[model samples]
Target chain A: MNKRELFAQIQEKKSFLCVGLDPVMENIPKHLLKYEDPILEFNKQLIDATKDLCVAYKPNTAFYESMGWKGWRTLTETWKYIPENIFTIADAKRGDIGNTSAMYAETFFNREKSEMGFDAVTVAPYMGEDSVGPFLNYKDKWVILLALTSNSGHKDFQVLETGGQKLYETVINTSSGWATADQLMYVVGATRAEEFKQVRKLAPDHFLLVPGVGAQGGSLADVCEYGLNDSCGLLVNSSRGIIYAGKGEDFAERAREEALKLQQEMEQILLSAELI
Target chain B: MNKRELFAQIQEKKSFLCVGLDPVMENIPKHLLKYEDPILEFNKQLIDATKDLCVAYKPNTAFYESMGWKGWRTLTETWKYIPENIFTIADAKRGDIGNTSAMYAETFFNREKSEMGFDAVTVAPYMGEDSVGPFLNYKDKWVILLALTSNSGHKDFQVLETGGQKLYETVINTSSGWATADQLMYVVGATRAEEFKQVRKLAPDHFLLVPGVGAQGGSLADVCEYGLNDSCGLLVNSSRGIIYAGKGEDFAERAREEALKLQQEMEQILLSAELI
Candidate 1:
């Protein structure tokens, strides 16, 4: 999916919040464990509850992946559960050699496969274009390349100055040519609100998938103030802050409450920005 | 497994090869499709056939992830098929918030739900430390962070000069402090033969996971000459070039042949470096 359509969805729903699907086995309701696939069951209910309040579903691949086959199966089924209007993100930080990356593109975006149909994918920029370009090759597919992340270790390297500019700034400037904003987005951690101003200057038109809000303590207002563009080009993701909001059997309802809170805030932001 | 143990395995086998398990559904023998899971069947035979020939088995997550639930199961089963002596890698370039990353750590390294025991995992360094630190928290678990990539787009950012040093160099120099060489490694794409010398200077102690040596047109001898350290710290990976050497019924046999060829070359490099 391209940024234009994503914006339309946000306008239609009056929300910009992207619910993150980062299900933890133990964190899931005890009742789910009785089912053959607890992860899948939990994910289905979560999607059912919050799909209408959000414009996107960001499934952090590591969560399902850690479960091995069962987790992976859960992720696939979860992808199917998301509504058609809501964009799907395969939060798999995949970036590899060219041919290998091409297959990754096929795995996530190819319609022929039984796998989930993700509108966009989170890509690691470290491997450069060969790892990312293959994902971009698919028509209308979006690649959310990593730039300045919100993590504490982000200071370890992402903020390091190289030839005057920070490493992430260089990544943004250099990778702009691989694909257009229509097909390429970036993962700019929400906690790095200060850097978004600089990041916007680098890729003024591209979308930014911002994590680290809610549970991680990143300010939503600060992110909107600095990160949003004219098209509402930002997907703010909250995983633990959303999915694990309540540990009880009413987990989905609690999830909806958390999602509603974000959506309500996003609705106001979209209104002020005149995006809706 | 820790670096020392992984090295010991390499010494015992006299090979520095890390065979990539990137099984494509279409690439495997057609007969395997008749089974409940073609990808799993192919991976099982591949692991069984090549277990003794190499010291590490790196399963690129995208290949199995694309298969949806069935694909995930195949990855789990494949992980099970690999012997304990042979190090296994969940080649999933994962990085996210601290809480999310911690769960990812559990997913890949948690032995409690033991169907698969991967010794290490490939992580994207773009998110900085919080995204990477969780992976390192586990004792004996190794995080192979991306350093210099082999893709054409790699030139877009990884090689960009930042404060006189390239972006990738900064990632290596900065991330090295977060974890010891025993816990951290770097991905130096084999295709970037010219940059290995510089990468070695920055990360002399950390092992390098080198991809693009075969089908991607990278020179194995070139990377070995410049990238090899005193510890023979190189896990040269050949995915498509080795795994899909032939598409016929004897694909597994052909895969063994291709792997053997690379193993033979790696053995010579190890011997010449006096690592054994």
Candidate 2:
């Protein structure tokens, strides 16, 4: 989705919340195992429960890939199940050299090639320009580059000083020149609330896909404090907190409750910021 | 495979070559289309032809993933077909937060979970410690981290000066502490011949998975000049140059001829270095 279309969805739903459809079979509700594919059923119910309350669905491909080709089949089915208006992100952190990156891009962005075309795909910036440039070739698709990740490992290399700036900062500055806000987004962990301010200085116009808000202990208010822009430039993702909220038969309803709470909070934030 | 076993295989074959099974549907020979699965048949023939000559087989994940789940199935079948003595690498270049990386580890290393067990999987070091830590959890598996890549974009973030050390250098130094050389390896592109000397200084013991030979214009001689360690710490890869060497019914024979040429070159190098 384009920046304007994404912002429009956020305003219409009164939310910029992107529900993470990351399902693990053993962790899913026991009763759902009766289905042909428990993970697919689980994801379908989650989407049905929370689709109205959120603007996007991000599925981390690792969860599906762990299950093998069957899991990949589930991922493609799940992508087909999502509503077209809502943005879909293949949260597969993929990157490579130029020619290889093109194939990776085709996997996530070209339905004719991979039978799964996500609205956006998270990309790793380690290999640099050519690795990221292929995803930008998909006109309306988004490339969410990893920056200031929430994991503890983020400090290992991302925060190291590079030419008087943090490595993540260098990532932003160099990558920003590759594409504009229209087609590019950044994955800034919600846990790095303080760093959000610094990130804003470098990339004010680009939307940030914020993970770690719910299960990873990142505060929504702290993230929204500086992360919100005129475009509601943030997609705060909550995976386990919302999807695995309850394991009972009413799990989908329970998920909606969790999503509704976040949507309500987002609505208030948008109203206060006069963004809606 | 562990370091000793890998070196043993290199000595046994008198070659430290890795065949890259990166197949494109459009690129395979036209006659192979008569098969139920052209790509699988193509890979089977290629493997059968060159199994004795090379020490390892690295099927880049992008080629399979581009075809979607069916492609993933092909990858699983291909992995299962490789000889147990030869090392297998899922050249996925995958990385994510800790938990997510764990899932990726399962996808490539834990065959029970993913139906594909590779000896090593190439990982991107953009996220640092936790991202790479999970893959090391597997007893005999290896994590080949991306260091100096073989593309123009390698100049982007990889060469960025961080605390007076290059980013790729920092990747090696910090990551070396996470796992022993037995479990960890680095991808030093064969194209980056001059950089090999510097890389050797930081990671003298770790094996290097060198891509960008043949088609990418990397010299095996230049790489062996500074890259060869006592354990024969290099697995030079050539994808298009070896696999697509011919486009006719005699494609498999043509591929063998190409692989045989490299195997002979590698044999000479091993003999000269007295590594055999």
Angstrom error of the Cα, residue B138, model 1: value is 2.7
Kindly list the per-residue Cα lDDT of model 2 for residues B1-276, writing each as its tens digit. Answer: 789999999999999999999999999999989998899999999999999999999999999999999999999999999999989999999999999999999999999999999999999998989999999999989999999999999998999898889999999999999999999999999889999999999999989999999999999999999999999999999889989999999998999999999999999999999998
- Please report, in order, the local distance difference test score of every candidate based on alpha carbons: 0.82, 0.94
lDDT of each residue in A209-253, candidate 1, tens digit only: 998897778999999998889999888888888888888999899
User: What does the lDDT read for residue B258 in candidate 2?
Assistant: 95
Per-prediction TM-score to the true structure, in the order listed: 0.91, 0.99
Candidate 1 regions off by >4 Å?
Answer: A31-36, B271-276
Regions of candidate 2 where Cα sits further than 4 Å from its true position: none
Deviation in angstroms for A271 in model 1?
A: 3.1
TM-score of chain B of each: 0.96, 0.99
Give the CAPRI rating of model 2. high
The true-versus-predicted C-alpha distance at residue A35 of model 1, in Å, is 4.3
